[model samples]
Target: MSTANRSVILAETPTAGAAVWTALAGLAVAMGIGRFAFTPLLPLMQHDAGLSLVQGGWLATANYLGYLAGAVICIAWPPAPARAIRWGLVSIALFTIGMGLTQQLWPWLALRFVAGAASAFVLIGVSAWVMPVLARLHQSARSGEVFAGVGVGICLAGLTALVAGMTAAGSQATWLGLGVIAASFALALWRPFSSDGVQATSMAGGARAPLTGQAWIAALCYGAFGYGYIIPATFLPALAHEAIRSPAVFGWVWPVFGAAAALSTVLAMRVLPALSSRRLWAYAQLVLGLGVVAPVFAINLTVLLFAALCVGGTFMVITMAGIQEAQRLGGAQPARAMALNTTAFALGQIAGPLTVSLFNGGLKLPSVLAALVLAASSLTLGLTARASARSAESRQQTEIHVIRDAGDARTNPRFEMS
Candidate 1:
């Protein structure tokens, strides 16, 4: 209402606590509008652009390869947060726009690879760069919503592509135009991105405590999560259409999945109160696995929607919570802990598509078998959760002993006489 209040609201709303989500939304648009949008528009593009299915798929793979590379860079460089963020933005813009700038398969493959690399950086950098500031800025519960921005962006891009299709044109060139728009999306993020009013320091002081034994378990669990949810996140809508043969109804599902994730995060805040990130993450993974498994048996579009509502919705919560849990177990070197988790997640993601490809588009018994493997790995969460609890208990005991020893010396008669 008042001037100061207005300024405070602006400072805190999109720009505070979970501002990285806002930044992520922009990156998501840059990353998703072209990458995910391509899947929906692939048939049209293949026909109009004179592209083959194999080549088009390769383009997608190239982007993913680049994304993996970006993740590697993120894990390797902990001291360069701002630099990473800036480079990520630049790479996103370049690769996103590059999608529209060229049409040939060779050139497109190069750009898609670039885009994938940029997207990976953005995802990894958020954990490496923006998360610490967010944790200190807002309640742990609120950070859950930040990861949902990917869904929001994905949904938005999907909706954008949908609308662009509904237009009389519905041409593949429209995809290029969407790519053009994506190129500028990240530019809006050029301003200083602060989380909960904390300017991100390129490097924070005070070394993080070394990760506990449990930390590796959490990393492995997070990695498993990467494999479990990505298939649904990336392919659910396509599956919806293929299974039900209704792109219109099915196409809208991914956004709902994104919205589901966004709302679930806000909901989890009301339910889970502590910084027990490992438990929250494991819980999310458990939900995610069910979400993934449910639709596999879905007889209709409604089944897919239910799966989206469950697993698709909780993806961000698991990711944010995993990062937090690792931070909790990690004593002085959170950067290193984060790096470990980053590496594991990257490995899982790289494995996701390859594993799915082996399924041959879920044709035979192999697809169902692979899905079962993912469902089983979801239990990795429970293992990590137990590890986190043990680590927390150990930390509490250490602190209690420190306090007790300090108190005993203070109370000793000799010290008092002196």
Candidate 2:
């Protein structure tokens, strides 16, 4: 290739990669730090911040409540995706740092609520904005690459806590440190999320489509995945702490969970390129169901780790597939559809801690709920398949009828006589 050709090729190479990475960074701050920094740090809060288990549960609920509210607002009154992304990232950084500035319970609750809302806005906004660009670039498969940020963020949060633990930084210092990190990432990603850079695509028919039955099924399954995963995710360290009573060992559970999650999404795309998003989603749901029940059968550290691997590995991949399916079903208005799924997911997260609290045990009621929802999700897939088949059959019959009518008209005796 000539020098100019080489320069053009080199420039094109970075465009897709840069877009993907920018998205990755955006999600890391919005999701990894804003939404989930609390999970790994929950144990830390108990030790240093005088946070009770009940209070921690309430805080988790508060965050999800904020997330739910955010999703609702996004759907009811859709905003420009680019603007939402920029403002959401800034809000995430501010609220995350705010968590460290105040140790008061009410203030912490308020900050967490805002952070949760910020995270949801970023998630929905980024998905709305980025997926289309990738599709236009014929990089639809790379959407998984974008969604991998959630796991990356989760892993980074865990690692940060691990480092904090090593330095004896306590919860307050850890919060401050993560907040600064989130702020830096937000500042870096601000450029990519600009209004001029990420133009909103027009939906087909110049309007958003109504949610279909299949879309609702996908949303429900997504919600189930959220509830099922949050239990092990939110409380794994605490569970490990109960068994080992050492931060050294228990601290590793979250990192392991996050590492598996981060890797799973990337691997899933390569492993299942031919797989339909719905099928991938269904299989992931099954795996998550199995993971949820692992601790119920055995309380060993090994079993918990296995459970973490299962839940972490599949949740994000399922999320990616679910969102893609929503877009496929809803068409043109994927953001609206995605917002609904996010709302359902937030509801599931809100319910998870409360369910676990009610049971006061590991992996009993939550496992059952996860399994039941997974089963229902699978059933919905079957129904959709059957419905599709029947529609195909009806189309074939109509075609046959049209052919017969045409033949009869051509063979009419009056026309032959004329």
Tens-place lDDT per residue, model 1, 169-195, is 453455566656665655666555333
Segments in model 2 whose C-alpha atoms lie over 4 Å from true places: 1-14, 196-198, 202-209, 360-363, 385-418
**Each prediction's TM-score versus the true structure:** 0.78, 0.86
Highest lDDT model number: 2
Task: List model 2 lDDT by residue over 127-213, tens digit each.
Answer: 877776676678878887888888899989998887777667988888898988988887877776765233344211224335666
Backbone clashes, each candidate: 12, 0
Model 2 weakest lDDT span, ten residues long: 197-206
Model 1 residue 386 CA deviation in Å: 3.7
Q: What is every candidate's alpha-carbon RMSD to the true fold?
A: 6.6, 8.0
